[model samples]
Target: MRKNIMNRLPVILPVPAPPPPAHRAEPVLDLAVPVFNEEADLEPSVRRLHAHLRETFPYPFRITVADNASTDATPLIAARLAAELPEVEWIRLAEKGRGRALRAAWSASSAPVVGYLDVDLSTGLTALLPLVAPLLSGHSDLAIGTRLAPGARVVRGPKREAVSRCYNVLLRCTLSVGFSDAQCGFKAVRRDAAARLLPLVRDTGWFFDTELLVIAERAGLRIHEVPVDWVDDPDSRVDLLPTALADLRGIARVGLALARGALPSGRPSRSYAVPVTVMALAHLLLYAALRPAAAAQAVNALSLMACWVLAQPVLGRPPLPAPPALPALAARLAVTAGSLALLRHAAPGAGLRAELAVLAAAHLSLALPVAVARSARGGRRCRTGSAAS
Candidate 1:
């Protein structure tokens, strides 16, 4: 009976599929576009970009457009482009934001060299070649098309130029950002870098580009800034004051992140002394508020504050060698000033209480390490080490 049953059943084993080939995958250059309500410029810009890509970049290429929940004919145009161009694909973003859309598109694309150019083609199609060249050649991990550099030419109105200069100056001074012009939208990165940056960044609005570049810089990646001919599109989406304020906030965030060593190095330090300097100035302001002639006293106080703040970092403790607590104190002061500054700017009188609170917090933050050190030394003196043991 067992032999008969075994013979009746046809033994079947599943066929094993071969493993994927071990050959290295070729890196494909993808031009990632974040398109919002760009219905008017959609076709023309895409055509121009396609033509440029065809003429230049003699490698595999694909265009990924993240259609940012456009309210106009932008989505329709993107769908049509995707259908017409084999190398083109559209990623629909439910929310609308230039930076957000671009990030979505880059993440969805399957190319190695990911890049984004303004929908208006402000940086010109000619600049695209150099933008992605560094990534392709393996010379640089990221490339940015800069408009304010020496060889770059900007054909915008005087107002735009003035605003751009002022905005950049503020960023440089506050964040100590090394980039000449961080706002230029035409930037590209290697697939690895793009993949790394897309998830690390949180801002999805106009400030996204700035955050991306800063993160890249902090990651110790070589960012090549390429000068290009940039003419401002009359229909630029940026609002003057609001956008300026937003960018300032972004700069501050980037600076704080950098100081905290949050991006790549992952080290902790209180090296942000600028905020302490600002706090010292605030103290001076408070003194002046009480007495007009107190400015001299305030100045002396500020000088003392500066010296104390500077000395801890520059001069290490003799007995114990460790990171200077100056950075830690400065960081605390900066945190306080930033909060107070925002409140003061947004709601002038409401920040007074906040200012007092922050000042107290700053003093505590600065004093803790010294207090701890002193306490430890006193405890050491009170005990005979081996005898206590």
Candidate 2:
């Protein structure tokens, strides 16, 4: 049997995320800081974050230092912080992927809300409240701190800025997504939403963040965006080329899934056999009523289009496909036109039975493969780690 990848936790983390912060009631929010080799910065960062949360946050909070296969003193630093602070805890994973670390930490969190922040703290801490407020108040399913949104301030090299803008634009143009930024490290989710979305997100690296947000949006969960003040971390370990290439591949994978209406919604997808039968029957009745050749052909075309729409499927909370996007809508129309044209120009003398046959043959052969799917809420693709999240 192909066992779930999430079960293969680093031996060091035989235990899950740290026990509820000792002495305090269970936290309302748990902040995950996923790290690899950051001995020089982890301790101070955690301390700084702890101080900020203690001073500003209204409710109890927990900080989990998720060290993913660090080869340096990072684990030691994280352990020390966990030992010294009542609100702090740490976990060590065997693998180095950030997505893997987050999966482990977030999956084990008990708080009503769970979120992650990069250890470098590139985004200012002030946005933290707005980030979680929506989830806490039951106004939003997820909250994100976006550098690309209006009123946000960002200081990054031109290259990074360009890449960020381009990547977001690609998401808008290809996926027709509403969120301005997909990979912002500063984000939080209501536990219930996370529980539903996590298992379906597939990427295990940087793309993990984007995948999670995409799934949340597609599932009809509300997302609140916070315009954050951010400063670029020069020491950031992310390699632009590899990350960008990976993101492109991720986009393509997701786009194809949306196009096929194959995104898993954590439910059993219904068979379309019934819808097709209904469509065929409806077309016959409509054509019988509108006997003029052009009108009868039009009726046949409309029924086929309706069948295509009803058959589009996406795995989601509603187990519904996104309304088709422009390309898809166009494709469906073109096919409908071609099908009607064929019956009119090629088989003008055909009887009613022959017309029905040709209509069915045209749609089965030409239209079903190409069209009807993915609205602005285009299906979000979930990958491996996320796929089993």
Best candidate per TM-score, number? 2
Which candidate comes out best when scored by lDDT? 2
lDDT of each: 0.67, 0.73
The worst-scoring run of ten residues by lDDT in candidate 2 lies at: 267-276
lDDT of 2 by residue, 167-212 (tens): 8986765555789988788989988888888788888899998888
Q: What TM-score does each of the candidates earn? A: 0.65, 0.66
Clashes of each: 3, 8
User: Compared with the true structure, what per-residue lDDT tens digits does model 1 show for residues 1-389?
Assistant: 53454243222211111332466344387777777788889888888888788788688677777777666777667777877766666766667777877776676666878888877888877787777777888999989888788999889999989988877775665555678888887988887888888887878888898888777776678889899999899888778877865675566556555554566742233343333333333353443344334433343345445645544432342234545566654565465456556656776665334555555455556646755786687588778675677
Model 2 vs truth, CA RMSD: 15.4
User: After aligning candidate 1 to the native by TM-score, how far in Å is the CA of 261 from where it should be?
Assistant: 3.1
Off by over 4 Å in 1: 1-27, 266-270, 274-389
